[model samples]
Target: MAPGIIEMLIVGFAVGLTGALAPGPTLVAAINSTLKSGWKAGPLVTLGHAIAEIFMIVFILTGLYVFLGEYSLFVVIVGGIALIVFGALTTLDAKNASVDLSKSPDNAGNPVVAGIVTSASNPYFWIWWFTVGSALLLTAVSGGVIVFLAFIIGHWAADLGWFTLVSTGVHRGRFLLKQREYRILLTACGFFLIGFGIYFLISGMNL
Candidate 1:
């Protein structure tokens, strides 16, 4: 059965949150922008990230969908496994995960541009698209365009939500969440990912 809209949203949020928490250039860009541009940097950076994701999907659509359409089950299974692995990692790492809102050097570029450039340049971003992202995206697409859009909306919401909180906290008080709270949040999201991974696994089997 295709996931309901709510389930899709949860899945997207969980998966996207898992990605956003990881240390990466985009995270750096977000932090730096927050330092230079204040709370607006988070949303602005997310807007750029959204653009980059769309651009990547467009690029993947050129010929990738042809193959994906044929081997969607395989893709879903792979995605499920990846999600499980990622979730496990997230859960384990949560114990030590820290959100650093510290100001770096004077290297604050345009928040939007930095989001695009940092994400595009990150190997983790490409690996995600090629592996886990493509799979969940295939599942979303199989459900029809509305579901696909829902997935994207949920994904973007996660990005916007997190960065917004980070920026708000950073701009107002240098750190939005304390280290312990951040770890707890990470652990919760990790478990959410694991659950979604299992859901995807079953969905693939049904297909």
Candidate 2:
């Protein structure tokens, strides 16, 4: 069952727009990176997010065919533990979330590390794996890899576009600032991260 161009476009548009627009961990990271580190860090962080998504897509595509609907309490428990740890770390960091404006941009590794850690640590990836992600793969069974690839490409492009816009806006607005306000914003972000982590933990436990 080959997918028509219209079907491909629909999936592409739906996935791209929704995924790019959806407010989540990655979006927060992108916004924060732009505000703190400027354009260089923001895009690097976004690339890191893309890497995480690649890993997730690969994991889901390969294993889900066999693991679908098989409840893995162990995985759930592990994820829950991770969430609690992540939440705790975020809460602690909230107190020291200040970014140094004068910090050299030569440290390329920071953005990459930040992006990877931010995306990988997020538990929502697992939920997406089971829901819309799985559906995409299932649809691909009839629609073929072409459709899957198209959707993935579209989704990533949208992510790039969205983050670029955010980065541009932040840079143009000179979102960087003096030390005190920076610290406050960082603390606020940290609080949000902690809150998200706790929510993920609780949701995982309930499931």
Candidate 3:
């Protein structure tokens, strides 16, 4: 069955949260900025990330989908495959993932700029847009613009919420997230991604 608008929103948030929790350049930049600045760095950084993604959204929505036309359904298949691969990798890496918030990199620069540069420069970001993001977006658009907007809202919420928590915890020296907890969360998200990938593949083939 095709997922409804609410489902899309929920799925978007879940997937976005998984992405946010992963160790990446953007997250590192946010941590460095938070250690140097304050809790505000997380949201500010996410804002810049959102800014960079706006162009990606425009490109995928206006060009990629339109160009793909009838073959767009295959995007779902590709996205499912990518998700499975990403999930397996995430799960395997979770056992060893360690975040060091104390080691602030001097070159973090402005939190916003770091977010933009790190996100835009990462090759995986584009790959994600071409696969997972595009597939999820196409699924959302199938339900109409309102549904698509819901998905965006959910995704942004996760990004903002996760980063804010990380920054706040770091700035306050709370050190709330330990390695064990982080690994568990990653493992859960990895399994969730795999499950979602299966569902997406089934939906795509049937749709």
Candidate 1 whole-model C-alpha lDDT, 0 to 1:
0.83
- lDDT per residue (tens digit) for residues 14-106 in model 3: 888888888888888889999777999999899988888888999999997897657856888898998888888888989998777767558
| lDDT measured at residue 103 in model 2 versus the true structure, 0 to 100 | 32
Q: What value does the lDDT take at residue 109 in candidate 2?
A: 44
Ranking by lDDT: 3, 1, 2
Candidate 2 clash pair list: none
Q: What lDDT does model 3 reach?
A: 0.86
Q: What are the TM-scores, per candidate, against the unseen true structure? A: 0.93, 0.57, 0.95
The candidate, 2 or 3, that scores higher on TM-score is: 3
Alpha-carbon RMSD, each predicted model? 1.5, 9.4, 1.3
Looking at model 1, residue 145 earns an lDDT score of 80
At residue 147, what lDDT does model 3 achieve? 89
| Per-residue lDDT of candidate 1, residues 13-127 (tens digit) | 7789878877667887888898889899999999989999998777666657887778877887888898888889889999888877675827788999988999888887998
